[model samples]
Target: MEIDEKDERIDKIDQILNDEIDIDVNQEGEEAEFSSLQDKYQINSGEALNSSDIYRIAAKESTRMIVLVGPVASGKTTMETSLYQLFQNSPVNDFCFAGSYSLQGFEQRAFYTRIKSKGNEPTTQRTSLEDNQAFLHIRLWNRNNNVISNLILADISGEAFTNHIGQVDEAKISFPFIERADYVVGIIDGEKLCNKKTRNSIVSEMIEMIRTFWDAELITDGCVLQIVFSKFDLFSKVENHNLILEKIKQQIVARLSELFMDIEYYNVAAMPSTIDEFSVGYGLEDLLQGWVRKHVRKSSRKMEEPFDELTEYDRLYYKFLGELNE
Candidate 1:
C-alpha cells in the first residue's frame, strides 16, 4: 500500500509537470498563458528543492565548480582522494549530490577533445566526461540540515600552468568547464617550501606558471585560491623550517597581490604516501571545520597571510631597494 501511494504521488506530479510543459507549447503566441505556465512550473520546482531549502536554492543559483591547480607532485591527487573518502558514502536525508559514481581523477586531454569535437552540441551526459581528473568538478545537493552526495569533482593537468598563457586565452583553454566553476584550489608542496635552499626555485616557478596559465576572471569571482601545502609533516623539523614556510608563503602572496589584489590563500595538508605514521588525518576535524566556513564549503563529509602576507627575502630585497633610492 505504501509503495502504491508513493507511485501515485509521483504520477500526479509528473502529470502536472507534463501538462504545464504542454501548456507552454500551446501558449507560444500568448504571453499571458506562457506566464501562467511559468508560475506553475516554478511552484513545482520549489517542491523538488527539499528541506534546507535555502542551500538548495543557493546550489541551483550557483553551481560550484572546484578547480584544483598545482605542480606535478604536489599531492593534489592525494588531497582529492582524501576529500572523496570523506563524503563518498555518507547519508543525507533530502537531496542527491551530482558526482561521478566512480572515484576517479580527471583527464584533461580527453575532455578537451570531446568538448571541441562536439562543436556547440548539447551534451546528453549530466556531467561531461574527462571533466577534471574526476576529482575537480562537483555538483552538490542539500537535504534538511544534512548534506548529501559528494558532488562531482574535476582536476586538470599541472602542465597547463607551467608556462605565459594570456588570462583570456587561458580561460578559453578550459572553455565550457571554466565557465562552470565558482571556486578553485591551488596546491603547494609545503615540504619543498620549508626547505630554504629549494624554496625560491619552486615558489618563483609557481608564480610564473600561474600567469602563463589560469584566467584572470577566475581570479576575480568566487574563486578561492586554496594554496594547499601538501606534505605538511615535512615542515615539522626545526626552527629554520618554520621560518622558511612563513617566508615562502609571503612571497607567493605578494606576487599574487601584484597581479590582482583580491586573491585569497589557503593551506592544505595531504598524505603523500600510503605509509603509516606522518599521515594527515589526525585532528582533521578542525581543518574540515575551517573549510566549511569558507566561500566554497561543501562536502560528501570532509574537508594565510602575507609576510606575517610574502618571503622574508623579498622583504629584504625591498629594503635594499629603499636604501638605493635613498
Candidate 2:
C-alpha cells in the first residue's frame, strides 16, 4: 500500500510540472504577439534621415524640398534651427509645428545655442561634409487651409558646394538632389557683408556658386531661387545699410534674372548678438510665409495620375517633378 501511494504522488507531481510548462508556452506566445504589434507600429528613430528615408516619407505626403546652399559659417544651419526653435514657442506664419521625424537632429543642433549650454554666446554647430545624412524634415500644418505639408530641408555641409566652386561636372555628379528641389536658397553671410575686406569676395563667390549650379543644369528654371542674407542685424549696424542692400540686390538681379523665373530676397537675423535691439528669428516669419504661399499655389494645381509602370516612390517623385516643371 505504501509503494502504491508513492507512485500516485509521483504521478501528481508530473501532472503539475506539465501544467506549468503549458502556462509558460502560453505566456511566450502572448509576448511574441505584443512584439509583432510593436514592430508594426514602430515610431520614428528621431535622427537625421538619409535619401531613402526622405523618399519613403515623400511617397506618402505632399513634400517640398528646400536646399540651402552657402559657404561655411554662412548661417544655413542657424536658420534651420531658428525655424525649429520658433515653432517651439508659437506658430510661425500661421503654420503650426505639426511634427518632426528628426527631433533629435534639430535638438542636437539647437542645444549649443540654448542657455542650458553655459556658453558665452549663442553658436550653431557646423555641419560636416562627412555626415551620413543630409536631410532634416518637418511637418507644418496650415491654419488657414487646414492642410498639412512636409518640408525637407537639405542641410548638406557648405563645403560640398564651396569645394566644387568651378567644377560644374563634379557638382552635377555630387548633388543630384538639386534637380528635384523646389526651392534653392542661396545664403549670404551678413557679417562678411558688413566687413569692407570680405564683402565683395563674399558676394562674388555666392554669384559664382549659383552660376555653377545653373551651368550644371542642377538648378533648372523650375526651382525658385531665394537670396537670403543671414545675420542681417549685424549688417544693418553698418552705415549706409540701405544703399549697400540695394546695390547687392541690383547686382544679383542683373546677374541672375534670366536664369530663374522667381527670385526673392530676405534678411534674417536668426540669432542676433544684440538681443535687446533685435529679436531672435528676426524676419524668419516672412520667409516662412513666402514658402507657404508658394506651396499653396503649387497644391492648387491639378495633379496628373502617375504612370502605372513606375514604383510607388518613383510615381510620387515623378508626379511632383512634373508639377514643378509645369
TM-score winner among the candidates?
A: 2
lDDT of 1: 0.48
Stretches of model 2 off by over 4 angstroms after superposition: 1-40, 295-326
What lDDT is reached at residue 213 by model 1? Answer: 37
Native-to-model Cα distance after best TM-score fit, residue 17 in candidate 2, in Å: 25
lDDT of 1 by residue, 1-326 (tens): 99998887567557656775344444444444655767666632211121233234346544344556666666555555554444545622233345532322333222322346564521112232233323333344555545533333345455554532455565555534543444455666777877668778777776765554344444433344555556666655546765666776788777765543235554555443333545443223334433333343221111122444347675555444332221
The lDDT for every candidate, in the order shown, is 0.48, 0.85
Give lDDT: candidate 2, residue 158.
86
lDDT winner: 2
lDDT of 1 at 313: 73
